[model samples]
Target: MGRQSIKFKRLTPFFNRQRLEQQFSFQLTATPKAIDKRFIYSGQVTERQIHKRYGVIVSESSETDDYVLDDSFLIWQGQQGLVIITGCSHSGIDAIIRHAKKITGNDKIQAIVGGLHLRCASLAALKERKSNRSPC
Candidate 1:
């Protein structure tokens, strides 16, 4: 017999509101856009735009350096490749794309949406400046 594993947890209206709110602080809010695409879907779930509203913090490397565990959305496109959506790409967009390609084994990228936190040279320097730099 072949065993199948479910990869994701579906959030539905019938879910336990109190438990979810206690654990994850669920809030009723507005929706900017919605798409129905099987198990994968896209939506503008937050009003905050441009720079990330939170989670971005300064690393010990520099006082001005910003870092974030960027959240990404992936959708496989048949012939065009994968569509990537990001929320403040602190790891660099190119890096993200490369990683996606490597994981999905697809070279084509159909589309990219959301914020790309590109900084000026000065900002980049400040951000990259760390007390203990490690060689890769």
Candidate 2:
């Protein structure tokens, strides 16, 4: 599947949450705009093997999409190589790695730390993944 575009209208509720919280006497800072493009990894990945069943509801109207385009991975460049920090990796680990490489223009991944989201994967799939591994 191709990358999907998210409309700004769908994000209005999230951006306006601070106003909603004010009614409850809770203080919250205004939501900041997204990071600049240069700091973000905007390319698509080759494989989206997992989290295919996941859906994202981006608006109050409950519109949903099968893919989570907002998912991200934190990459740190070090003297040794790149360290990737992720949360759940809803986009798939392989995809995250590929995107990280594309963004940094570096293929040397030093370490990967965080959730792989493989709990629901079948044993056969796990075995296949293990068998396909190559030394880094």
Clashing pairs in model 1, backbone N/Cα/C closer than 3 A: 61-130
lDDT of 1 by residue, 1-136 (tens): 3333333455676567776777685433232122343113322222122343333244446333223433444444456557777766655555666655555566776776677644454766645632212211
How does each model score on TM-score?
A: 0.39, 0.57
Give the alpha-carbon lDDT of every model.
Answer: 0.48, 0.64
CA shift at 122, candidate 1, in angstroms?
Answer: 13
> What does candidate 2's lDDT look like per residue over 63-136, in tens digits?
66657655666677766777777887887777787777776787887888899867888999888766654433
Residue pairs of candidate 2 with colliding backbone atoms: none
